[model samples]
Target: MFKIRNIGAILLVFFSISLVNAQIKIGDVLPNITLQDTKNNAVKLNSFKGKTVLVDFWASWCGPCRLANRKLVKMHDKYKAKNFEIVGISIDTDKSKWIKAIEKDKIQYVQLIDPKGFDAKSAVTFGVEALPATFLFDATGKLIAINPTESQIITQINKK
Candidate 1:
């Protein structure tokens, strides 16, 4: 019985550590992940340093993600010239479907393919558990918000 209890305690501690490590909190530097764009060009998350960026994690099959993309499109247009950028990371394993959704949504921002669905490396690193998850980073690549609303994103972009 003592051995079983010890094993249970160890398992609990291991899971606790994992959960803590998975979280990417505000003020944490964005993870350095290299993913491919729609055109198959390698893009690194760190490359966006020196620019305010919104990293959006989404899937083509998610209806809420589609709606969020529409709002993001408008935000992109309004803020692109202001040095704000949006990086859409699709968690869709189907490349064609992901590209189709981008084209249909008229998304002009940088689009990346995760191809791992919810278990994508970036998603796991950032602890993204839901569709339409967004992380806002400052010009220095430090995270500012997580799952922020469209208005909250715009407000952050508009800040000096």
Candidate 2:
């Protein structure tokens, strides 16, 4: 009986480790996910397959996320013509507050809402344990970097 219990514990630990390492990694293809905009319009991530995309998960209450938006706005402007896009996914449960933040930040990128916040299935799929998690993918839909900085994004885009 003790041997069986020990074997069960070992299996549980192995599965836990697998789950911890299940996050999408660099070079993995971006999974096509259909989320919605403020107007409830369906938007698919793979719709922008030919453009370099940065999928950012943020919340209105997160200060760091708000700060990141300020920098991302500038980056988007410089690379918009180069087929670059930033998809801002807000996990804020309050729709009004999320919209206000977008306006306050003067964010012109494609904005989507999860509304479920961290409990969202999309959050689990993206393996987002914290706010300001970002995945930068190339024009070919291959992830190039995770939580990339402005310089890193610039370099990756230039490489393509």
Candidate 3:
């Protein structure tokens, strides 16, 4: 009975670790997503490879997203010259509303609209179940952080 119990415990631990390691964790190469920018031009994710990029998934109707955008604006202005870039991906069904929000917030970064809303391919590919979700990628295009805080982003930007 003791041996059987020990085997069961080992299996449980193994499965737990596997589950934790399953998702797109840090250091993973982000998938390339080509989408239309606010100007209706096609933009590829790889275009930002040579710079540190922040890919933010947000929605116009989400209050938290708006708040996060405000913070992002400040961050962008502070680190833009340091090779830091922000790509705002809006999962908004209404193109007009998305454009309006971008103008109202004065977002100076690249803004992309996903007309599929929550079901957007980019959102699904990134497993984004929440608004204001952000992924930070290094100059080499390797994802360095998932859902990082404002300070965390700043720290990464400051790193050599």
Candidate 4:
């Protein structure tokens, strides 16, 4: 009985470690997810496949996410015409709060709500563990960078 218990504990630890390590990385194709926008519109990631996309995982309650939203708005305004888009995927528990933040931030880019916290299908596919996480993809729909700052986004767009 003791040997069985010890084996079970080891299995549990290994399973947890694997779960935490399950993550999307650079060069991985972005998974197509159909999440809802504030308007209840179905916004599919694959819909904007041709353009270089910046996928930002954030939540209204997150202070850093709020700051990142401000920067993302600026970045969107600057490079939108250059075939770049910033897609804000909110991990907010409340849809109303997510919409309010979008209005308050004047975020012009695409926004989606993930009310299931980080366990939402989109976040799971992207393996997002924290707020304000970002993934940048190129025009060909290939991920180029992960967790890039606003300045890094600007530089990447300019390089294209």
Candidate 5:
């Protein structure tokens, strides 16, 4: 029994290490992954370089995500001309659900799905493990903040 418990502990440690290693961090260059937009047009991250970027990781099923969309839409309208852009990375597994939510919520920002689901390359690159995670970047494309709230977006914009 003791030997079995020790083996289990070893396995747990290895699993934790792998998860940690997979998480992305500050200073990591955003990977250039392209996905179809709500309009079914291909959009790439590289196209938004030299602009302030707000990346929101969400899913169709998440209530907070839906709520956040309303504020995001307003922010998009407010700062878009200032070269600020918001992008939604949907971690939802169902394509229909993602598309429906985008329409239902009237989300005006650019939206994309992790066709690979939650463990998608972009999610890993952003070290995202939770829904409604947000990352803000400067015009130079470096990460400035992570997981900021709705009001914080306003403050950040005003600062810029």
Candidate 6:
């Protein structure tokens, strides 16, 4: 009797988890990745240099992410004119559903679609292993916190 095991699959799983765990920390600048807006416009992370930006990694299929969008809408409205912005990078492969979610959620902030789902380049850049993952960055584009609450964003953005 011969026993066979898929070592490649095991290695892949191990390596993927490690990659997700290896994330950029506070004070580290988020890697500049270009994403597409609704109109397919190129939006680069570096373009938001002087604004306090929050990059929210989410998907249309995730309920928590949709729930978080409601709060994010409020935050964006309160801070948009004050040099604060929320860049929502959706990890949804379906553009139509992503747009529907945005419209339904009333997310007025910047909505970018990666269309690669969790395997999107933007997700990899941010090491996003979970939905609703948020990275808060200061005006200088340096990461200040992850999964930051409304209060934290309020405090940090107000400081600038």
Clash number for each model: 0, 0, 0, 0, 0, 0
Using lDDT as the measure, which candidate wins? 1
Q: Give the per-residue lDDT of model 6 (tens digit) for 1-160.
A: 1223577777889998888666677888867788889889998977887899999999999999989988889888888989998999998998999989988999888988888877887787787888989999999889999998788999988994
How would you encode candidate 4's per-residue C-alpha lDDT over 89-115 as one tens digit per residue?
A: 988999988988999999999998878
| Winning model by TM-score | 1
lDDT of 5 at 130: 79
Question: For residues 77-157, could you state the per-residue lDDT of candidate 5 as single tens digits?
Answer: 888888889989998888999999988988878898886666788888778877889888767777777886666666766
Q: Report the lDDT tens digits of candidate 3 across residue range 52-142.
A: 8899999889999999889899999999999899999999999999999999999999998778976888887776888989999988889
Q: Each candidate's lDDT (Cα)? A: 0.90, 0.88, 0.88, 0.86, 0.81, 0.87
TM-score, per-candidate, Cα-based? 0.93, 0.89, 0.83, 0.87, 0.80, 0.85
How far off is residue 75 in model 5, in Å? 0.9
Candidates 2 and 5 compared by TM-score, better number:
2
Of models 4 and 6, which has the larger lDDT? 6
Taking every candidate in turn, the Cα RMSD to the unseen true structure, in Å, is 1.4, 1.9, 5.4, 2.1, 3.0, 3.7
Task: Please give the ranking of all candidate structures by lDDT, highest first, separated by commas.
Answer: 1, 2, 3, 6, 4, 5
- At residue 93, give the lDDT of candidate 6: 90
lDDT of 3 at 146: 91
lDDT of 3 at 42: 96
lDDT of 4: 0.86
- TM-score of candidate 5 on Cα atoms, chains taken together: 0.80
Candidate 5 stretches greater than 4 Å from native: 1-22, 150-152, 155-160
What is the Å distance of residue 126 in model 5 from its true position? 1.2
Candidate 3 Cα deviation (angstroms), residue 137: 0.7
Q: Write one digit per residue (lDDT tens) for candidate 1, span 1-160.
A: 9999999999999999998888799999868899999989999988998888999999889999999889889889989988899999999999999999999999999999889987888888888888888999988899988887778777877778
The list of candidate 6 runs beyond 4 A from truth reads 1-22
